[model samples]
Every structure is written in structure tokens, then in C-alpha cells.
Target: MAATLRNLKIKTSTCKRIVKELHSYEKEVERESAKTADMKAKGADPYDLKQQENVLAESRMMIPDCHKRLEAALTDLKGTLVEIEEELNQKEGPEFEEAQKVITEVEQVLQSTEA
Candidate 1:
């Protein structure tokens, strides 16, 4: 029971952190893209534009990897939940609720990406 609760806490934190990381990566890509666009609009040097494009591309690449990590983390959480569902019913607490919330939030994130 203690182990299950600990797993729930850790998985919850992991999922939440992944969500934040994914959002940060997306914002970084957006910011870099805007910079690249602005540089083009300003007729920035070709070499500088290429470098900014590279940065933007790198940022864009991270997003897919982050999404994969998020999916894996969600799966891990779900598996943990399934392992302890009987225990969870007998020992519902804030940690369990938090885990459920994170699962829903991650699913929403995944759904939005699909759309």
C-alpha cells in the first residue's frame, strides 16, 4: 500500500513535469519561429537566418520527443493505477486523486496534439 502510494506520487509528478516540459518546448519553438520570421522580414544576413532556422528546427524536433515521453509517462501511470486499483478503492486519498487528474490532463494534451 505504501509502495503504491509512493508510485502514485512519483508518477503524478513525472506526468506533470512532462506536461510542463512539453509546453515549454512548444513555446520555445514558437518564439524561435517568430524570431526567424522577424529576421527574414528584416532581411537579416543569410548565415544568421540559417542559424536561427537551425535553432527553430531543433526546438521543433524536441516537441515530438517530448510528446513521446508524455505518452510513455501516461502509460506508466495507467499501468500503476491498474496494478493498485483494488488498493486504491480501499485507500482513496489526495495522491490517488492527483494521479487521476494528471492522467486526464495528459490525455487532453495528447488529444489536442492529435487534433
Candidate 2:
């Protein structure tokens, strides 16, 4: 019957479409699996390795900026502290000596950490 043949043609077309979709899905999965295997073989810890590398790259880029900022701050702090200490020493006050000791310790700690 002609109606039967038409129904068969429709079913066949649907089957072909489904097969095409399945093949595409299979290829995508295989591609992902291969990529995963390659990464594993390279001993790449994708979790932090990628993120850490990105962070390191960004931090490296920021190093100059941060160094500039820290250097400026250290310079300003050192100059101010020295001026204050000089004034205090001239006056011979307990407050001046105490302040100098605290600022000096802080500067040392900051320098050590930066190093």
C-alpha cells in the first residue's frame, strides 16, 4: 500500500536523524576523554594547576606595581619616622625613643616579609 510505504519512509528518516545525533554525541565524548587523558599524562592537576598558573601570571604582572607601592610607602614611612625621632632626640623625651623602637621593628618586619 502507498500509505504503508509513506509511513516506512517517515520512520526511516527519523531513525537516520537519531543515528546522526548519537554519532555526534559519541564523537564529543571521545574528544573530551582524549583531552582528559592527555592532561592526566602531563601530570597536570587541573584544579589548582591551571588556576595557580593564572594567579601566578597575574601576580607576576602585579609585582612591579606592588613593589613600587611598597617602596614608596617604606620610603615615606622611613623619612617621617626619622624626622620624628630627630625631633624627639633633640627634646630627649621617652615618647620619641619608644616611637622610634616601634617603627624600627615594624620596618624590619616589613622588609623581611617583602624579601
Candidate 3:
């Protein structure tokens, strides 16, 4: 049970990293989109616009998959917390309390992402 909990902690950490990286990617996409629009308004070359369009298209495709993965990771984290709580016989110990705090934080992040 200890090992399983440790693994779940590691997974949760990784998921957090993934969420951070995806947010960075999203910011980059937004910058690129704005640049693309600026170039279009300035009558930039078709080749440049096409390249930017392709990048935006690719980002649009990947962002949803990233969201899905993040959601799955959050679900896994919640499930692991439940298992750990069950293993501990639902005792109100420090570990369970910490887990609940982490779960709440994760849920907040998930909610922000959805918004």
C-alpha cells in the first residue's frame, strides 16, 4: 500500500507538470495566433500565413488531447485517494487529510482549466 501510494504521488506530480506545460503551450499558441492575424492584416505572404495556419491547426488538435489526458490523470489521482482512504479504514489521520487537501487543489486546477 505504501508503494502504491508513492507511485500515485509520483503520477500526480507528473500530471501537474503536464498541466503546466500544456498551459505554456496554450500561451504560445495564442501568441502565434495573434501574430498570424497581424500578418494577415498586413498582407503578408501567403506562405507565411499558411505556415501559421498549419501551426494553429496542429495546436488546436493537440490541446484537446492534452485536456483529456489531464482529466484522466485527475480522475486517477482521485481514485487513488479513495483507495488509500479505504486502506486506512477511513481514519482521520494526517495522511488522509493531506490527501484530501491535494485532491481539493487538483479539483480547483481542473475547474480553472474547464473555465
What order do you get sorting by TM-score, best first?
Answer: 1, 3, 2
Clashes of 2: 0
Candidate 3 lDDT by residue in tens digits, 44-80: 9999899999988887677777878877877887787
Tens-place lDDT digits, model 1, residues 6-104: 888899899999999999998998899899999999999999999999999999899899999999999999888877886556446798788888999
Error of 3 at 10 (Å): 1.4
List, residue by residue over 7-115, the lDDT tens digit for candidate 2.
Answer: 3334334333443443454455555556556666788877945654554455445444444544454454445545544644442344435435544554564465365
Name the runs in model 1 displaced over 4 angstroms: 87-91
TM-score, each model?
Answer: 0.94, 0.35, 0.80
For each predicted model, how many residue pairs clash, with residues at least 3 apart or on different chains? 0, 0, 0
Candidate 2 local lDDT, residue 115: 53
**In TM-score terms, which candidate is top?**
1
User: Where does candidate 1 clash, by residue pair?
Assistant: none
lDDT of 1 at 8: 80
| Per-candidate local distance difference test | 0.90, 0.48, 0.74
Name every residue pair that clashes in candidate 3.
none
lDDT ranking, best first: 1, 3, 2
